[model samples]
Target: MSSPQPPPHSSPTQGAPPQLEQLFHSYGAKIYGLALRCGLAPKDAEDGVQEVFLKVQRRLGTFRGEAALSTWLYQVALNTLRDHRRRVVRQTRATEMSTLSPQAADPHFVAPGQSPVEQASVEERRQIVRLALDRLPHKFREVLILRELQGLSYRDVARILQIRQGTVESRIYRARERMAKELKKLGVEG
Candidate 1:
């Protein structure tokens, strides 16, 4: 699902108390997008978003503003989604969590000016890249999503993943290499 339209007024600053509904309206799409990129099936990603908001509701009082609200939100989402994946995997021992649902394709990933055949080709490649991303290890996927897809800086990614900046850099580099390998296996050029 696409993100909800942002609230009409200015969002609360980082230090302010998180208005749960407002935050959901403001950032739910972002969180959902993150879940999708992290390889959660679309249905699971939706459920994961709900779970993240529920955790936020319970812990909102504890937010100390030590980090940006967005950062804390991402941390909560990643942890919640990770736990959710583990539970699902344990429940269904043979299920593959990395399979991309057909519905999971983001229409926005398609560029505007391409011809129909070109668009189809581009989307095919996008799906292949997403599949490669899904196949990545969680450590690699997390860093790549945060640094590349979410466009966070190395320091911010380090903060979100609670790793050293150097580690984030290294993970991103390795993730890219792994992704290239995966795409090549799928017949996509670098």
Candidate 2:
């Protein structure tokens, strides 16, 4: 499918929501990935994507085109996920920790070659990092996930999070320091 073009002026040309299928085709995977990286279970991630698109369907006409569509969609997705988190009781860390598996490993961290023992060791480190990340405050975690894990530019993260670029950078720096402290508590050195 061809990409959905932004309207020349703010809002859709005729106050119409873009076709749901077109929007989903263009962004579903990215939204799902963001949900998963934010610590949602696979099923929850899928559901979150649906919820985000539902919002888009309902409110796309309200979008002013001041930001890129992806940015606006991300803002909606984060708000949806935040609301969901507040509505649902959280799982204990032990239960949540067990949910991480090899399939969920970040591709960016994969090594081309490793002995079985080394692979197991690497996986252990990843689990530790996940635990450390989960311990971070919401604001810090959001920046790290967007900037470091999702590999978004500082500018894009500021737009999505609705914060200044300097705020994003400072939060990331603080997040790294806190992550280091958490890892140290778990006996992993930086």
Candidate 3:
């Protein structure tokens, strides 16, 4: 079972409204992980953070506590990613497919606390794991990352994903097994 999260500023007597900055400060890492594993490239994930908050800023008053703030934020993030992906597809059609890559200017995905050499190794490993993760279908990938990487509970994941807990469990199991197989195919058996 998961530990209970205290409700955030549930009532007027509970305190002030949850600030956007505070939300970012508290949930930014989890949101970023969610975006990355949801199939956004690292660059798009960063941009998606801004877009997610913008939508939140616009629609916040409507939230009204029907669900946890985290659950609400996850929904917003997913929507924002979908919108961004759509825009990309449209632009690709308009521009007739430029071959230029955005990756050269994209910043590092993982933060490092060690020497450059160590950081490089860490980055390499992360890229490997991300590649394996990318090979999975989105449904399995989303469930696996939400539950495993972000440490959200089954109940939380089910609510955020709008799916049953049993589906989450089965998808997670398949995702893990598939990821392991992908890693092994790259000569990275563990």
Which candidate comes out best when scored by TM-score? 2
Please report the candidate that would top lDDT against the real structure: 1
Tens digits of per-residue lDDT, candidate 1, 1-112, equal: 9989866546555333447878998999999988776766788888889899999888888889999999898889889988986665565566754444534666756566
The C-alpha local distance difference test score for the whole of candidate 1 amounts to: 0.81
* Candidate 2 whole-model C-alpha lDDT, 0 to 1: 0.78
- What lDDT does each candidate get? 0.81, 0.78, 0.73
Q: What number of clashing residue pairs does each candidate have, in the order they appear?
A: 0, 0, 0
lDDT (Cα, 0-100) at 189 in candidate 1: 79
Give the deviation of candidate 1 from the true structure as CA RMSD.
8.2
Pitting candidate 2 against candidate 3, the one with the higher TM-score is 2
Global fold similarity of model 2 (TM-score): 0.78
Task: Kindly list the per-residue Cα lDDT of model 3 for residues 1-190, writing each as its tens digit.
Answer: 9999898865657752469878888878777766665656666678777788878888888998988988998878876866775565477679987322223223455454677888677666666776676677777777877778778899988888898999888888888898899988876867
Q: Is candidate 1 or candidate 3 better by TM-score?
A: 1
Candidate 2 at residue 45, lDDT?
Answer: 70
| Candidate 3 whole-model C-alpha lDDT, 0 to 1 | 0.73
Model 1 clash pairs are none
Among all windows of ten consecutive residues in candidate 2, which has the lowest summed lDDT?
85-94
Q: How close is every model to the real structure, measured as TM-score?
A: 0.76, 0.78, 0.65
